[model samples]
Target: MIQLITLDMAGTTVTDHHEVEACFAMAAQKSGLTVSDDRILAMQGLHKYFVFQTLWEEILGTTTHPEWQMRVDNSYRVFTEVLENHYLTHDITPTEGCLELFEYLHIHQIKIALTTGFYRKVCNIILEKLGWLEGLDDTHVGTASTTIQASITSDEVEKGRPHPFMIQKAMNLLHISDPQQVINVGDTPSDIQSGFAANCRLSVALSNGTHAADLLTPHNPSLLLGSLHELIPVLEDLRTRS
Candidate 1:
């Protein structure tokens, strides 16, 4: 039986209407980086700082270049400013069926943990806006009455998506040892890759988020969902089989 469910923020749980990509583009423009939208989208679910570092390295052909660190820092700073401001000033809402899914998990005695590419500050901002941080402490770990059992950010770990650090951190925080007892769900290829890297029982993808089904398919998610509500039957089926 699945004991924990790890969900990605932004496109997976929170409503994302390309605002992240827009922020990345704005930052790139300000930092004089010539990046395309597809490139930015491709980096979704990665640590924002790592994204900038990789982008700068790709453009300069080498990280040893003198201007690499400066470019990466400047672009990352701008991106963080833009992203944090966007979340602070704009309306933030849960994706469709998100609350319902949460309720289902709660009723079923399953633990819910959120994993995000966002840093802690921005992640807390979004969670606060949705009232999802009510009972969580400064570390963002919640109790039985709280909406979620844990919240893990990319900054909290040594590496982000496509690596399993964040997920492993969540498992550690929740005292879950076997990855086979966890189900990971997200809307990006990096998210799928990370879940599989963690050796999760299921690495599921949602097509209605940052990337389309065609784009996420190559990552080989165990299951692809069109909406959050679809997860209910899948979980039920898994429980039965297990």
Candidate 2:
């Protein structure tokens, strides 16, 4: 039986379009980098540091240096300060049907794991802002919140997506020995790749994230659902078939 479900954050769990773009723009300017909305939107689903390095290099005509990394770090700290203290409070919110889905999964005795490319600090800030930290410790939630050195490290080969280490770590943390008994629900192609890397029994992509249905169709997900509202019904149908 599928006993665990690993979820992705960002566009998958919380909805915040303007806040993300505004922060990126302001951070880029403070770091002496210039960025456009199109570029920022195009790089959605990528890790924050990678996005910073990529955009900084693209804008400043050079790759990142240690000093540049420091600047980026400072800019990001300020950005996150604003995000957590203000923007997040005003902008970020959970998707439709998220609460109902969480309750259903809990009642079913299925473990819920949350994995993200983001470091624990940033993840904590967002989760705290959204009141997700409490849920992270619930019996049903398995979170990748440990120190990178202490925790099973996720690989970021050739970019974070289309690689599997993040999801694999989630499984390990959740004590899910059989990937075939776990399901992954995410909003990006990287999520699918992680599920495949972990050899998950099932992977479902949702249109509620960065990409639209027509765009993500090319990635060939096991199934595509419009929103979290469809999760229970889809799983019910899968159960019937089995």
Candidate 3:
């Protein structure tokens, strides 16, 4: 009885390949802050600006610092440029069997929405590159799998993952109520937390994306999957259970 499935953009539906963390790391360094890859990866599924804000605060050891906003802004601006250029110049691919999963959901009359921690501009760039924007309507773009019902981004919401704003926004736009009829799938702890906050019937994680199974495990999703391909059977099973 699932009405909608909200999937994350990077690291969940799209391939990460460590590019995101690389960009963040470079941006941090450019802003005069040194950060580890693990720390950057741990911040996945959060709003980009908030990520810099938190990192800057921690690096400087004080939120009360007068230059906090300036530093955060500088780091975030650099990160956005780096990330967008990386996606635009580099090859980006969707996760294995991602398109097939979209087709299955489409055939079942289950709407799919992409909810991302990324801002709208870069999201469009990635979608366009993958041809996911083909035949796009006002709400969403179409891919080989199916036409998405909506594409919600972090900037579109008051807050990002772990706050459930993006998922909630997608549900509202797609006219989906009853969180029990929703499935939120992601590759990070924040993604799992966000789904649960929305009370989704299925809050699942994919280890093949961003965080490893070990990192996502403690978040306690309904299940942990390896890739989007694995979710097809689970969805079919859920249909049967319904």
Q: Which candidate tops TM-score?
A: 1
Candidate 1: residue 240 lDDT (0-100): 87
The sequence of per-residue lDDT tens digits that candidate 2 reaches over residues 1-242 is 76777777766666645456677677767766667877766666567677776666665557645466666677667665654555435646777666677777676666666666555656666666666665344332433432111122122233465566666665666677888878887777777767777788877888877767876678788889888888888766766676
lDDT of 3 by residue, 1-242 (tens): 99999999899889888788888888988889788888888999899898888988897788789998899988899988898999889998988879899889889989888999889899999988987776766766443354677788888888998898888888888788888999999999999999999999989999998799999899889999989999999999989998
Judge candidate 3 against the unseen true structure and give its global Cα lDDT, from 0 to 1. 0.88
Cα error, residue 96 of model 1, in Å, equals: 1.3
Candidates 1 and 2 compared: the better one by TM-score is 1
Better of 1 and 3 by TM-score: 1
Score residue 113 of candidate 1 by CA lDDT. Answer: 96
Q: After superposition, how far is residue 99 of candidate 1 from its true place, in Å?
A: 0.7
**Ranking of all candidate structures by their lDDT, best first:** 1, 3, 2
* Alpha-carbon lDDT, every model: 0.93, 0.65, 0.88
For candidate 3, report its TM-score: 0.95
lDDT of 1: 0.93
Clashing pairs in 3: none
